[model samples]
Target: MAELVLVTGGSGYVAGWCIAELLNRGYDVRTTVRGPGKEESLTQAVSTVADPAGRLTFAVADLLADDGWDAAVKGVDRVLHVASPLGITAGDPAAMIAAARDGTLRVLRAATAAGVKRVVMTSAANTASPSSYATEGTTDETLWTDPDDPTLIPYRRSKTLAERAAWDFMSGHEGPTELTTVLPGAVFGPILSTGTIGSVGIIGRMISGSMPGVPRIGLEIVDVRDIADIHLRAMTAPAAAGERFLATGEFTWMREMAHFLRDGLGPHGHKVSTRQIPDFAVRLTARFRDPSLREITPSLGRRNRHSTDKASRMLGWHPRPAKQTVLNCAQSLIAHGAV
Candidate 1:
């Protein structure tokens, strides 16, 4: 019998790709959805890459509530805890932190009780970043972001806290289940569906001419497919237990990404503008017109870069070029009519 793997939040952008990759690798996969209605969309999206056939199944579970988690993990050998609350617009930071931190514990508790062999959780590269991104240097998994830093955004704080909580939980845990985490940078790649693009939305916005000019922000690009690959590697690798791996790929500025879209996609990338927006203009708009812009304003002149040497050496993981990822992202959005 094939090993059964449980993936939380089956309908997510990254989770959808994870399911496809697992199914492609001949694993019998079961995924958690908030409701039954989400199964169809997840199936449709994953079907684009691999045939789910009899290998794919769905379980109803939610991060916010304790219900259905045990059944969701029942009979599974391994777990991929990919589900977590995320948003760009800062609302109540406390609520996001609670959902991420408490929700992760909920999954860990269930998996430990079920005696699952391993659980690979998805964290963010920002979680390993310094309190200030202005510091120019290469950082590895050894660095931990201070969650209590007041300058930290809600999303960053939530991810950092959640990962920390997971480590803390496993520290005192006397269980058979092992835990590993894969931290990814800005995830961009082919979209299986137009449903929820997540961070890939930045590419869609650029292609749609949503912004008059590009912000001075920079991004460490990682393909969604590569992110999925790292997750699977973490789940099975012998050296991955109780370790965290940074999965960042090539670092590219928003301007470079815009230029790639414009030159690579031709007609499809017609709307992409490489014009750099003045930092002052962005600050002014963020101050009054849009609060979401505030989240990225801090990254205006970002100099920090994350190292993937740990993943490369331990798991033989490698990501594609930033230009290719950006071009592919734009092409996918065009095919889906999302731009």
Candidate 2:
């Protein structure tokens, strides 16, 4: 009999790929949805990459509530807790933090009680980064971002607090189940469907000419497919238990990303603006014109990057090049008519 793996947030971009990969690897997979309405779209999305073949199933659950979690973890061999609040752009910081932290705990408590072999959770690379991206140095999982730092954005703060809460919970845990976390950078790659693109919307904006100019910000771009691969590796690796692995890719600037799209997509890339937006202009726009740009002002001329040597050495993981990931993301957006 195949081991059954329960994946939370089956409708998510990363979670969808994780489901597809698990099914392809011959695992009997069960996933959670907030309601029945998402079941059809989630199945349709996962079907794009791998067939469920009667091995896939669904459970109704919500992170903010506890009614369905226990039943969701019944007889599960492993768990992948990949759902997090997507309030990175705008939301009440306190509300977002509460939801993310409490949601993680909800899943952990259920999985531990069920005696799942391992629970691999998805965290962000920024949770291990310096408060200021201008700090020049390569960081690893050993470093923990200070959640109280006022400079930290809601997304970073929420992720940091949530992961910290998970570790704190595990420290007191006495169970067979173990916890592992995969911290990915800016995740980008092919989309299974057009329903939810997540960060891949940045690529869509560039391809559709929505962005008039590029910022000086740089990102450690990792592919969505690679993100799913590392999750599976962490689920079964003995050394991965109770360890946090940084899964990041090459650091590339927005201007370079624009160039990659322009050069790689031919007619589709023609509208990509490679022009750099001045730091002052971006700051000014964030201050008055568009408040949504505020989240990016602090990232101008970012100098810090993360080291994935730990993931490579421990899990034998290697992410594809940033250029290829960028081009593939843009092409997918075009094909889906998302642009």
lDDT of each: 0.92, 0.92
lDDT of 2: 0.92
lDDT tens digits by residue: candidate 1, 231-264: 9999999999999999999989889998998899
Residue pairs with colliding backbones in model 2 are: none
**Residue range with the least summed lDDT across 10 consecutive positions in model 2:** 84-93
Per-residue lDDT, model 2, residue 82, is: 94
Name model 1 segments beyond 4 Å from true. Answer: 87-90
